[model samples]
Target: MPDYKHFPLADTAEGLTEAEIIDWKVKPGDEVTVNQIVVEVETAKAAVELPIPWAGVVTELLVEPGQTVEVGTPILTVDVDPQGAAAVNGSGSAASAVSAETTETAEAAEADADEMKPLVGYGSKTTVAKRRARKSQATPAAPAPEPVQAVTVVAPRPASEQAAPAGYVPLAKPPVRKLAKELGIDLRTVAGSAEGGVITREDVRRAADGTAETASAAPQPVTAEYDPATRERRVPIRGVRKATANAMVGSAFTAPHVTEFLTIDVTPMMELRQKLKGAPQFSGVKLTPLVIAAKAVCLAARRTPDVNAVWDESSGEIVYKDYVHLGIAAATPRGLVVPKVRDADRKSLAELAGDIGELTAVARDGKTPPEAMLNGTFTITNVGVFGVDTGTPIINPGESAILALGAIRDMPWVVDGELAVRKVMQLSLSFDHRVIDGQQGSQFLADVGELLADPAVAITY
Candidate 1:
């Protein structure tokens, strides 16, 4: 007879009610040690790995990959002692007798293990059948979702899923990566035929059948061939994309938005950027216009603290933050993610540039930790990379303001009372009208533009 214990899903972060099981590291009958990583799950924020609380032989995996379950639901079960195998193998009958006698010890250890870890509001440790019975009685079963379309872009893999020295992160989308994992194919060995070396569903299928293609050929488009009769594709709104949609809707509707625009001659800024590129101190650092803008936002916030503040709606108070936690909006394969650069006001220009570059990289790889996405005071979205002048950017939920940076280009400008081809750019700042007055918003935008127009003006701040 085996003594078993259930492992329930725990809240990995604040206010996260549910998570989708991404993949399992262990299956039935596999031996797992205490605090061993057992499964990976994707919540509203980011992907997280969960550890088993007890050392035991895994008796059953209650959940399957891709299934979304509420927090506190048991996802795994383990037999704490299957005929005292550890006692039998390690220290003979004396240890074996101890193992049998210490069943209560095993239970105590599991409880202590969970208490040591920071899993907020752990789910109930009940049998799976009871959970199903209660859930089914609460509501009528809904119709099944349409199969989600495979994304064309690649997603970064976890370290355990990687191969070789410190692991190689393959460039394949989530669906494609799942397929490769199921087929027992090594993604690193397969040459991607898609644009920018991204692996496709077809590529994975070919690799599975030993007929993959080379990287030299032109990238072929992934056909929407799932249903020829319908001639349509459907993607289920879940995970990051789903969360983004809800946040945007809530922010757009709730916030009293006011956008102000400014056109500036940033020839001096571009000149300064060129000069700094050759400097040893700025070596290997990305000193883009965004970096300069980031610094300007920090400096401008000192004059007007409203932009670096949030609305505490629940408490009916407008909170002003003394420190700046700057967020850079990044568009990733999954969705829009605004990861913060902590204490932006305290960092030098080079340090700010490095932090932004690193944040962008991790975000694009879909590896941004949940902690990175929280507590942002202000945000700067550089829409210039997409080659547009400027648009009204919605303020992030809870934050007071957002700035959109437009493309920098050679435009005809009256420089020093004369017409000249100067490096010009447009700035659009959107702020919550309730928190920021028109005068304050305009002044902050002006300060940012003035600093960019004359890099020397940063010292005056």
Candidate 2:
């Protein structure tokens, strides 16, 4: 018998450095064909199904669900046989034999095996990273076709006879799938109302909304493995989350930070905002203080370029950026993420507002691409939305400074030697102490303040 070789993880769709394994469609020794959806991966962008690249027996699952693996991490192994015998004899009883003696191991080891079986080091149990590439014979076989079943419904049929009428399609719609997920309903057991016994979206919705019970009958729970709880449940950090955790730890420990704060009267900016609300170009756009604040930061960055520079510790150099890739801190379903807007300084006020609106919408929907979150030159976090008045914000790694804009509210101000009501806001700027001196930080904050205080000055610059 010829000894086989190991296959390292390949770059799945672009150069996405990492992905979390969401679910495995195949296990060790399962025979799979080409283009068959073998695994589900959650990249930073969306949940995607990974089709098998080659036809063969699934030798092993390299990565476990929940682990955030780098782009080139070996996700699984396949025993490809250009000769064809391996697909038939090699997978049949041999697979069943392996399954009979299932190995129970430590969770970490199990996770390693599930994600990617690590290359074992000499005289040690620890797994070691290896080089990445693809095998010439790694192309998988064709997928099996769906079997057709026939159904006959008549008066007083057996329950199982009523169960799967020959060729009965699962009665459910996409929205019903979404609702079923939320309400813990099983659609497979629910009978359909559409032609040819196909399930309609309304059928699933009715069952999920508990309104179907008022009509004909409620669906009995399908004992099929499609348990809503089993479909998805939280797994504490193994896949993408673990990978993100490691990267964050690495960035945090390597970067040093410093922060400063300033209070300013933003009555003028507010007035300008009200005026923009009536503008033809800015019509239908959601113009908020953050939009103006973004503009102020961009304008201020033009005068003070150091605030937008990225510190490259590897090269022992400070990089002064010519363009602003403004990062907006957004809270997402997965975690806290900062997605950047490219060339933010060049965008018009209305364009900036639109881009901000779209990017925020994408982030909230958990559909933001990984590339959108990369290469940020500066970051602004709006704590005001959460009703936070002031906070010392931690600088986003690589970028020299992070600006925290607090709630703009009414406060007493001195005007012409008399107290007057005014709209005021607290701004906190945190920077890398090694890069930004206290004077530079203070001046930057003041520049931002001046723009917000008198919006007209922005035109002069």
Candidate 3:
């Protein structure tokens, strides 16, 4: 009579359909409290820690680490009343708990809603439950597993889809089955490299490529010590990396990009930075060229409002904004994330530097929230930190423009008609041609260059 509750996976971010389990904070037999961090999941935007809402003893972890599951799928089971007399008598069945949970899901499905919403919870939900397909590999000699409902990820297609001869079902995961179907590779003909003769996605791909060894349509014992999985390291593209790739691809293909470069002597800006570092007001603030460039972009945007506008395809209009949500492109070990500083134009130089420091630190730790990454009007990516010269940057989809700040090199520049070695940096501005005119783009670049070339010029703006 253990009061067990099957805890389903909840949507961690907006429009998030699925997440990959990174790690579990607790296991079976461990005690947990309400709102205690239970698992780490990698969503499309970031890595997030999810907390359990129900306090209980961890009975079972249904999902394994590195496995991706759609939102609302049950991930863990908790015995809510673990100390109950019936629970202590060891009468509670996890299978019974699953049956009850599945019943609840079936009841919810009978509702009027056609399109299911992801049960929201990482910050805000329960689930749209879909019972996972079971792993249908047969092992007549092996002992039967316990009668607990387990998340089965290995089988998706029925035996009829595998083209096997006379009552044979190929062992393959859902993704592998889909891949095999697309590539027209018969899973029954391909030899599985995985343990228990389970075919992998790579095996199906190799068979399609003609690189896999041809074997008779018969199951064979895996005798070789070498694991084909170890032949190459496969990093699953999930979280930020996957989202960034998709976003960049969309931006690059959808928007007509025009890039303009401007190289300027930042000797004046550097000198001002040094002087400000000594000032009491600027104490503890690490003001770099990028900070000045950000400020310059804000000031310049006032003169060229088109750079801070969005080209709305649905509305067929150019949407102008009075405020700037400046996106600072931060590169973490995971991938590139452009988290925005809300109302960046209104912030002072010192405020901008501090906000960026905290924002980037959170991003580097892979903790930037989904809302922090949205609603950016303009983006500034400091490639200079990587010691890279300027390259054309892609517009951040909805926004019109992006600025790439390059390395600050000590180069010879003509100063007052005299050649002098000074700190010079290049700025590359890429804009959506549909939103920003060539003249406006040039004017914005010139304004930013002028501000960096002479710090006093900001008084006029």
Q: What are the TM-scores, per candidate, against the unseen true structure? A: 0.69, 0.57, 0.72
Please, what are the lDDT tens digits per residue for candidate 1 over residues 193-294?
775466888898898897885332222322224566887786667778788889989999999999999999999999999999888878888899999999
Q: Rate the local accuracy (lDDT) of all candidates.
A: 0.75, 0.64, 0.76
Stretches of candidate 3 exceeding 4 Å from the true structure? 85-234
Clashes of each: 1, 31, 2
Model 1 global lDDT (CA atoms, 0 to 1):
0.75
The RMSD (Cα, Å) of candidate 2 is: 17.0
**Cα lDDT of model 2 by residue, 1-461, tens digit:** 11122333334444455566677888877887766777777775445566654566765565555445555344565655523333223323433222221221111222322333222211112444332222223223433221111111111223543544331223333455456546655554556676524456676677766675322333332222444866854444533345456656765676666667888889989999999989998986788898888999999998888898877878989899899999998877666677798999999999889999888988887667656777889889999989898887777666888899999889999977999999999999988767777887888889998998998999888
**Top-scoring candidate (TM-score):** 3
By lDDT, highest first, what's the ranking? Answer: 3, 1, 2
Question: Candidate 3 lDDT, tens digit per residue, 1-461?
Answer: 24556666676666887777788999899998878888988888888888877777987676667666656656777776665443111334434443444444332321212222333343213553344442333323322233233322122334534443322344565577668867867666778898646788889889999898654554422222544877854555667888888999999999999999999999999999988888776677677787888899999999999999999999899999999999999999879998998999999999998888888999999988777888899999999999998999988878999999999999999988999999999999999999998999999999999999898999998
Winner on lDDT (1 vs 2): 1
Off by over 4 Å in 2: 1-18, 23-40, 43-235, 238-252
Error of 2 at 229 (Å): 22
Consecutive 10-residue window with the lowest summed lDDT within model 1: 145-154
Clashing pairs in 1: 72-123
Which TM-score value belongs to model 3? 0.72
- RMSD values, in order shown: 15.9, 17.0, 9.8
